[model samples]
Target chain A: MRRLAARVAPPTATFLAGTLLAELLIRALGVSPLLLPTPSAVARAAWSYRETLLPALASTTGAVLVGLAASVALGVLAAIALAASRWVERAFYPYAIFFQIVPIVAVAPLLVIWFGYGWRAVVAAAFIVSVFPVIANALAGLRSVDPALLDLFRLYGAGRLARLVKLELPWALPSLFTGLRVAAGLAVIGAIVGEFVGGGGLGVVVLGAMRQQRTDLVFAAILHASGLGLVLFAAVDVIGRIVLRRWHWREEIP
Target chain B: MRGSPIVGLAVLLCLVTAACSRGGPPAGRVALALNWKPEPEFGGLFEAQRTGAFRRQGLDVEITGGPGAPIVQMLAAGQMAYGIAAADEVLVARDRGADIVAVYATYQTNPQGIMVHASRGVNSLDELFAGEGGTLAVEPGLAYVKWLRKRYDLSRFQIVPYGFSIAPFLAEPRMAQQVFVTAEPIAARRQGAEPKVFLIADSGFDPYAAVVITTTQRVRERPDEVSRFVTALREGWRGYLEDPGPTNREMHARNPEMDAETFALGAVAQQPLIEDEFTRAHGLGAMSLERWRVLGEQLQELELLDQEPVAADCFAAF
Candidate 1:
């Protein structure tokens, strides 16, 4: 009951308080509605540009989903490969660092020029930007496997693959997920920044609107992008909590 | 080590295949950069390419869309043989030390204008200024905001910092805005509202917009090539005004999102703007040294820069 009150009630109170304050401020200041539009004006603007707003939301979501999926796939595969061979990890770590070191801004245009605009370029940029954290964490996790744990599995004649699936991976899940959560926030940033620079999606639209001096619609798009990032982070957090709670014996709050 | 080379090669191969698959001509490779995106304003140049005007001049043009690209750096680095820059920008750049020149005029008029609602009952500049309730939508970075303040006591008028959207203007019925007549007015008309317009030019602020630019060094080195490019570009504009059919089809092909009517309107609107004796005397794609110098002087007065940016190198007199 306390958890329910804690989780569900503050936002309602805040929203009501916020509305009262906004209306009060509007009436108090003699401020022209055009320069600093009332919340109602923003809501009306939101309704007006629903056409532009909805597509941009869809575009940004699509870019983020596609990027996250790509990151998960590549990040897992890199973990597996690195788990199998230290030589590969040693040889490629510098290059991985190199890719991370080169600012995404520097690489974004060339990605567009090379990949030819729109979702493909945006996805590539996001994937490249976000996977590093997951990879770095997963690699560290794989290396963190207890020597005695490996030997215990091997004593039963467990093969390399089975030992990896059952023993090494379970051992690595907590650290790996830490990387993924860090990557989760970064994936959203990657999509927005990539689009800001050149992706031609909602990020582009938000930026274009701002450049053209359409702050109302720009803020509306920003709200959408924020809602998207928040939603993604929440979803990932929930999944991480569930998976980690069971796998690593993490306790549930309630 | 060996596999790395192969992987690198594969990436390059993919990039080349992506860039070249929608193939056109095979002249010496050249990149023409824009001040902005694939808007209707750029249709003439694209139409020129569609009509084989650039090809006839033995040029292979790769038009890059501008999105926060540091255009002058790219030009100075020899990435693009030609770039589009406003005359005011050209002046600031020259003063700040970028070696570029203006070779062509895309829009005869800059098309930058202040728009208001007809119902505002503000008959002229004086009336607009007199009103206590009106909000003047102005962009902060644009040079003209200062010009407006210098000429008028803007402290009295409620100034709304512009963030480019028609929604703000549409949201508030009585508000005034700054926008290009070619782009925003069309968008407004589509929304079933006729907008009142006042040109900054008429208000005594002078500068050019969407003028084709190149390095002065490149012009000196490849005079004939530059001449060929300019001549073809001029022919492109003429053909755009005369027919614009093939160009429209090509522009549609490249960016199908732009509607045909709006595209045609944008093209047609830009035509009357290409007047003034400078272009009239020589041909289209003409600029006046006197005009450039005058704009430079205004920019200096406006204090856009500390000094003049480029010599009045308007026409590429090869």
Candidate 2:
């Protein structure tokens, strides 16, 4: 309990201090709520609109989860195929990089045309934005197997399947988790962008508030989105620690 | 050597500042931020700028255009001297504590409407709402949608969110979507789709469109300048209606996404909406308090506004 408290204290203190300072600054500056609502006003708006906001949160969370799962499944499979041979990596790696570089905003409208303006388009957007990191990191981990260990496995007459299951797969776990963490944050962003273009989730809430000139509500919705991203990232981090604890115990030590 | 580099940096900065200020408008210059991209809806503003109507009024005006900008906030925050918005938007902004007042209304009737495929056999909004359900693409939280819900039974339609695209409507014969009467109908026609538009104004929910707005502070502090700007705007609209060829060419040059043909079509389509019997006697860009009051009441009935805003306070007719 003490350890957990110590671990939590710094961020808690910083957040409280920062929020207080912001409240004071906004009051001192006499900033208009339409321009920038104070933190207190944002909290009030959030509480007042919780009935609408909670459902929007659930809808966006569903899209993010489905998109992240699809990316992880496809990304890991593609990485394995690429790791099987140098020729495969040479043929397909550039395409993965292409997905990473293309801006999602430009592609979101096309998704609407294909998926017909609903959750499916949003999931496709989230998947497109987040899959590249997983593939890249997992491939890097698979390729970084210790040469001496590989030689020993070869000397033992282990076939390709045995070598992969025992050596490369375990070696790649940490790097795959790193990629998953990055993809989790990206999935939230992609989902929001999808919602912006295709309409559903918190993006619509933000758009409606903007059209209504409800800046306080806009700020409230943004805070909810950020909270969702943080929750997703923390879930990935916890799962990574648990899975890595057996073989990669030292790194997991607090 | 270090001091010499700093000296060179200072010289560069001075040169940049000189270039920025040189040949620019004078200190008294005012700017108008448009709520949408350059199109026929903003034809009169472009016409005024091209023909030196503003310069003749001794006012140097810089007009900037973009899609879905926060025009009311910019006006309230003093980022721009004037902006273009709908009368409903101005009222919503005032309700949200932005002290903006509409000075001139461009379209006597709102141009927003529902565009249905001609084959859908949907003649009236009632038929569309009451008939067998089909997909209707619209922005969900707009005041007009709420008003429509109160007045009709829209439960039959599968209302999807409209994202300013006509692709979905073109692809699906059974789909209907919201559009500006002056805009998407033209684009859809060019793309070989026969689209029938049902004007929302005909449903008794008309609010003035493309209203020229400014901070109430500006109206109170500089009434004469506001009057002059409105006068120049009226003359510009008159000229545009008389002969839109020159102004349409210039606007097309600025916004090449709109071809000359599209500009011509939009100009012809929006003419009747801009000039009608009311504007014929009251001059161009005229607004009445009764219309503002009715709009406010409608918004209040829809529960979008906390209360009915005072009609006189929402606009200043110079």
Candidate 3:
């Protein structure tokens, strides 16, 4: 209980303090709700529009999960291939960086044209924005394997697959999770951008509310989007903790 | 204490810079924020700037372009002295507690419509919506979309969000997307697609488009300035209708993404919408109480507005 409280206290205190200050400042300044809604107003709007917002949340969640999964699967496979050959990395790594650097907004229209506007385009957006981090981090981890370990595996007559499964894969787990944590957040952003052009999900909700000038509802939708991101981040963190708790160097320290 | 001199110098420099940036003749130097980028949709406003109509009126107007800017909010907050918006947008803004009123209307008829492939052979909104299911690209949460849903059974159609591009519509034969009559339709034609447009106005949801709006406070405080601005705008529009060559060239330079041909097309397309029978009789940028009341009631029916806004409060017809 003490440990959990210590972990929870700071964030809770900061959030509460920030909300209180904002509420008071808005009230004191007589700020228009159109310009800025009080936190309570946003909460109220969220609750009032729960039926609509919840479904939108689920839709966005589906896109994020699918996109993240694709990113992990493809990213890991590409990283493994790159690790096997320096020529492969040299040939493909620039394109991976290109995907990362290309602005999602600029390509979103083309995504709609190619993917035909729906979950496919949205998922593609999420995947493109997110896959680079996973590849970069996983390749770094796979490459960082100690030469001594490779020699040991070779001496034991282990082949590439066996060595990767027994040695490099386990070693790269922590780095892969770091990439996942970053990708999880990016997937949400990409999904929203996709929805901006491709249609569907909370991005549509945000766009609609913005057009109508419902700032309170816009804040509510944004809060829901952030909540989705947090959930994804937390899920990744929990998975990482579970995987790494037994053998990770950090776990062995304390 | 030693750092105070530097801070003071900085503050003085900022003031000097601010004053220099506010350069113009000693008159009412005001800014007009456009809801969209420079297009012939705002030809008259551009014409006013290019032809010195605003200058002649002793009002140096700086027109800033944006992509779907929150004009009503900006005006209500006094960030800009004038803005361009649709009449329905002005009513919606007023309903949301924005104290902005439309002063002059550029497009007497709203240009927003649905673009369907000519091959579809669809004549009206009803036939299109009730036909075999296909994608209909529209901006979600628009009051007109809600009105259409209420007025027709749109269950057959898959409504996707419109991304302000005609490429999708051109690529998909079954797709019908919302368009500004002067914009996407023209682009579609240029790309070798003959699209049949069904104006939303024909469906009895018409609202004046490209209306010049300002705060109610400004109307109350500076009536002469408002009058002069409206007069200049009317003259500018008249000048544009006669020959939009200069304004189109200037606007094209400002918005290079739109090629010269596209700008010329838009200039020709918006002429009929700007100069209608009502505008002909009542002079340019004319508005009516009945139109506002009808629009407010329609919005109220659609539940887009909390209540039917008073028609009088929505605009001041000059």
Candidate 4:
């Protein structure tokens, strides 16, 4: 209990203090609710609109997870292939850079046109924005293997596949986790942007609320989106910690 | 030179001149936020600026473009002097503790509607509803959509999301999409698709559109300014209806996304809607309490309102 309280106390105290200051300042200044709702008002709206907010949260979270999974799988495979051949990297890496440089807003409408609306288009948007980091980091990890280790594998008559499985995979795990942590946050943002153009998420709720001048609901939607992103990032961090621990154990075994 | 008598005298004269100028306030600087870009939907405001109607009232008005919800938010926050919003939106805003009052109604009838391809053979509302269930691209939870569901039996149609794009509707011939009666039909025709339009106003649920809104604080504190703004807006509408050529050219320059044909179509479609019986009886931008009452009652029945607002309190007649 003491350990948990020590961990929780700072954030809880900070949040309470911030809320108190905001409430006092808004009341003292006679600030208009339209400009910025009081924290209590936002909490009320969040509670009242939970029925609508829950499904939007589910839809966006589902899209982000599916999209992140696709980016990881495709990114890992492409990195392995690119590590094997300099010729392939020279020919195809420019396209990956191009994809990363292109803004998601410019591409979301085109994705809607091609993939036809709904979650498929949203996933494509998420995938487009996040896949590059995974590929670049994983490729660097694979290529940065020690020359002495390569010589040892060669002396043992180890094939390329065997060497990659034993040596490169272990070496690449930490870098891959680093890329994924970055991509996880980006994937949530991509999903929201996609939903702005394509529809069906908290973005839709925010847009509708803004149209009707419901500032409270708009803030509530934003809060939900931020919470979703935080949850996703935390999940990725926990998974990374577990995987890195195993990778360290495997290194010790050798 | 810093402390000489001549320098002191010059500085004194400068301060006196500055005080005189500052003491006599310049024309009350006001900003009017419009519902959309400077299209015909907002021509009255542009017309006001073009013809110096606001200047005549001792007001230097800045007409800027924004979406309806943000415009209302700005108006309620006292960031803007006036804004354009729908009557339903005003009612909602008022219910949510925004002290906004609607003073003018530009579109005497709501111009919102659904457009379907002529080839789909859905010419009328009943047929469109009774036909085999197909997708109608509309934003869910819109006031109109909720009202439509309450007013009709529309279980057959499945509403997919619409993001203000005509490309999806063009790609799927069977799809019916929400559109403004003045805007989308012209764009559709230009794209070589003949669409059959159904006006939401024709269904007898007529809410005012492009309503000129201002805060109750402004009305109470500066009633004269509020009155002048509303009157100028009315005159501006009348002037635009008489001849929209120069005013529209100026608007097109500001909003190049709309071309000549779209502007022309909007002017033609909006003229009849603007000069209806209520406007003719009172003046341009006139609204009736009876109509607002009916709308409020309907909204109450639809459960859109947590508590019914007194309709008279929602608007101020000039």
Q: What is the C-alpha lDDT of each candidate?
A: 0.68, 0.85, 0.85, 0.80
Clashing pairs in model 4? none
Q: Chain B vs. true chain B: TM-score for each candidate? A: 0.84, 0.90, 0.90, 0.89
After superposing candidate 1, which stretches have Cα over 4 Å from the reference?
A: A1-254, B1-27, B156-161, B308-310, B313-315
In the order shown, the candidates' DockQ scores are: 0.03, 0.31, 0.34, 0.19
| lDDT, candidate 4, A91-158, per-residue tens | 88888787578888767778888987788988998898889889988888898888999999999999
The residue-by-residue lDDT of candidate 4 on B125-233, one tens digit each, is: 7788878667687765578877778777778775666666788888888788898888888898899898989988887777899899999988988899899998898
Inter-residue clash pairs, candidate 3: none
Give lDDT tens digits, candidate 2, residues A1-254. 99889989999999999999989887786666676778999999999999989999999999999999999999989999999999999998998898799788777878888887789999998999999999999999999988999999999999999999999988999889989989999999899888877778987787677777777888798899899999999899898888888778434534
Q: Looking at model 4 chain B, report the run of 10 residues with the lowest lDDT sum.
A: B1-10
- Model 4 interface CAPRI class: incorrect
**Candidate 3's TM-score:** 0.93
Share of real contacts kept by model 1? 0.00
Per-residue error (Å), model 4, residue B290: 0.9
* Native A-B interface contacts kept, per candidate: 0.00, 0.25, 0.46, 0.20
Off by over 4 Å in 2: B1-26
Worst 10 residues of 1 chain B by lDDT: B1-10
Expressed as tens digits, the lDDT of each residue in B103-205 for candidate 1 is: 8877667788888877786766656766765666664346676677788776665554443456657756667888777777777777887788777777777
**Model 1 chain A worst lDDT run, 10 consecutive residues:** A29-38
Model 1: which docking level applies? incorrect
